[model samples]
Target: MTFDRPHDLLKRSPANPLIVPEQVRPSRPDWRVDCAFNAGVVQVGDETIMLVRVAESVAASAPGELRVPLLAEDGAGWRCTVESLRRDDPAYDFADPRMVVLRADPAQVYLTSMSHLRLARSTNGTDFTIDDAPFLFPSTRYERFGCEDARITAIEGRFYINYTAVSDLGIATGLAVTDDFRRVERLGLIFSPDNRDVCLFPRRIGGEYWCLHRPAPRHLGTPEIWIARSPDLLHWGRHERLAGAVPGGWEASKIGGGAPMLETDRGWLQIYHGVDAQQRYSLGALLLDLDDPRIVRARLGRPLARPAEPYEVTGFFDNVLFTCGATIRDDALYVYYGAADRVMALGTVALPELWAAMGV
Candidate 1:
């Protein structure tokens, strides 16, 4: 499938990138924000609440030196430690701007930056006010590397958040819920290593809770969207593939769940991201059977949105548009997306237009 930067059908906010790295204050004085994006958004009362991922680089060091932040095992727990390594050390490789790898031991890869979730508040859903400190910082051994991209699912009177936890152990998924954004109750690691991009359904179905997750492949099989159910929110089982990538298609490389599924009259509307051969990220829609979510009722043949504008085409990782959460207001679907994994932006489409786009 030829992408050629397919134009997104939604109407973008004139404000465009509503939130940037500079607008946020790093948790530590020595750290500087690299990028702030991939926020999990929700509408609470009259304000739009956003939990944005903010990745920061350590302060510059002496000439020829590199500072590597690590979580060292401290007896029964872990503690933050910074190690200094020569930039030109023969034992290390820094080809990728995202990380530094020990040449002889690739598994000893270290991120050049650490990410934390920041809370931002908006009244009109466009302009935002970012908090001075990180809303959610990496503290557990599982999140030694950092806590990144979060997806929110509001159920009952509380908000359920499933986020990616990065560590040397492996990329995994964790769960946390909040009554107010101020304090949270962590449920620890919900999905094992090499699994992420998780979203919990807003409500229970068939007297059980459901979630969408992506389990990565190391040696065999391809990365695809999968579904799981749980009696209690902490444990998940009964896993099955919900959607897979299409070879030579728009989603030829891989596909993963995006915003939590939106319930409609016809089915559960799910927004997901697709990566092509060039690693370009775009958005698509999948309508799942209302009663049986495992059944895919209809799918959007083309991307609902793709990297087109300057923001989407350039940044830390170019040609990417990713959304962790979306909300509906006055029949309009508000899509909060991250541009090139660098900044946060918003787009909107009428519910009717989206339904027609998917031909459902």
Candidate 2:
């Protein structure tokens, strides 16, 4: 609760990972995005865009054999192999730094984590530019195994975006609207598999349309947070499971809801992240029901931020903290996370007074 901010807003970025891939695969290496992500801010004419969530990964030398090699134009440059992989299948599972459950073939798996939706820009909220192509890729078929953590609300006039799609027919929830992020307007595979961190509740209540999801139950427990209903935020429904897992503290190993929830006044604040009992990762706060956002009027046993810096204690997946986007403006909020999955940083705190010191 003492997070005051500024010390250069948690320093250390001697260009740390900054943006990888000069050559890995034909050309699209890895931008890696899952947590500490962002999307939708837009002003365009004046500045402040931010669409990030790259995650590309495709490199191989000859060692274990999982290819993505390319570069055959015939004008001279050639490598070939286009695509051909196998990490032993069985719904796949290769762990260590590159973490890939890719579902080798539960019946038709097709995800290997390649997401794409880049572009950073910024004019007054610290320096940034990014964008070398990719405003959203992996086109259709529930993202063909790409796209992750995207939030971005805006509503009514466009800019919906609710992400995390993965493939092989699992881990769903996808939608895309966009206004000027160039173009995006997919809205496929609403919510399936074990679901994902959703959000989407930036207006509309009694009239329907609400979101916030999670649903990862397969051993029965943790990964809670649900709630549905929609007159058309893309069909939705009355689902409702709403928050769980605060039981013995720091989220007892499950908790979600980050970004796009924030309504204020004293409810619908939500800035979740929890996961403890050694899974580390923090940041919490909840206060729903701005007209039944699934009730849960207040909760925040601890953690408004944790993972005590070192660029969030090491990278490419270390003791991470994760966020996926945030942006309040004036009184400060900013928060953009994604440190240990390797890179992307910018944190801030001050709005709703960090949710009344998390006793919200």
Candidate 3:
């Protein structure tokens, strides 16, 4: 599909939806790429590399049945398996697109599509070539369900990767670091269960590493953005509530950290996504204090960009414009987002134009 600038604040790329499921090769022949989006982006040398989150399901399933992929814990690491369930069965409920839960035992659940991280490289930040093999797949216990939505922050010559790890225990943020993309050192789970959408600051602040994350509230508070500090990037502490969903606003449902923050003379510029009651997702900005990132200085009253085009309005999951990463080059901000949870797309916004919109 052609990428037209449906919204004026952020110009959509003509090559929008640059990466689609068809372009991505499945890890197994029996598996199929359901969607490719919500990628973590970084710049290595002259190439812009994206750690794309690719969700896959079985190639075929019997009529009136749903087949889901499972990674069994084998002594040698893991073995891929599939589970078939009768859709008409009263014991199962498929109310959510992401997972299926047993009506009797709510704890017992299976993901509709297994997710993994793959590499996609581009020299000019537009055209990309996807890697053949899986860059990071399910292996350990935390990643039994699969790893999803990677956020890359290059610090001290090494890229510190934060992503979502799904399993039976609950969803949490997982950390990993890599000097080269070929090999990664998994640091295990950093945030506790019932939390995700972690984005780290590029450098140290006041001798401590800082990050923004979202914790899913069970029965009390609603899902909101929170900040934390770490002395060694391993053990995090000093947690404080940053921001929450704006009631009766565009992001009235929930809000979470998006692309990594960019340090600027004004403050730390951050891009975040929010959902309303109708589940329409939109991108907004938050300006944090340069020294104290916990202090939110300015915020965009309106959406920077939202689902307008047909590609964004309909797909595997509709009306979503989620971004895991973005880059600023020569004063232009390039945002890589997943449109309707089906394909990867790029949006460009001049820094000056964005600043004017933010009134900062």
Clashes of each: 0, 11, 0
**CA displacement after TM-score superposition, residue 105 of candidate 1 (Å):** 4.4
Compute each candidate's TM-score over C-alphas.
0.96, 0.30, 0.96
> Could you give the candidate ranking by TM-score, starting with the highest?
1, 3, 2
The Cα local distance difference test for each model comes to 0.88, 0.63, 0.90
How far does residue 52 in candidate 3 sit from its true spot (Å)? 0.3
Candidate 1, run of 10 with poorest lDDT: 1-10
- Tens-place lDDT digits, model 3, residues 245-301: 999977999999999888877899889999998888889889999999999998988
lDDT of 1 by residue, 1-360 (tens): 233655677778899999988898988888789899999998899999999999987777889988877678889987777778888898888788888888774458898888889899989999899999887888899899889999988887899888999998899999999999999888899999999989788788999999889999999999999999999888999999999999896699999998987887888888899998889898888899878899999998888888887888888988899999888899888889999889998888898888887887
Can you give the lDDT of residue 249 in candidate 1? Answer: 65
**Poorly placed runs, candidate 3 (over 4 Å):** 1-8
Per-residue lDDT, model 3, residue 219, is 87
Query: Which segments of candidate 2 are over 4 A away from where they belong?
Result: 1-56, 61-113, 116-137, 141-145, 150-173, 176-186, 189-205, 212-230, 235-282, 290-305, 308-312, 317-319, 323-339, 342-360
Error of 2 at 133 (Å): 27
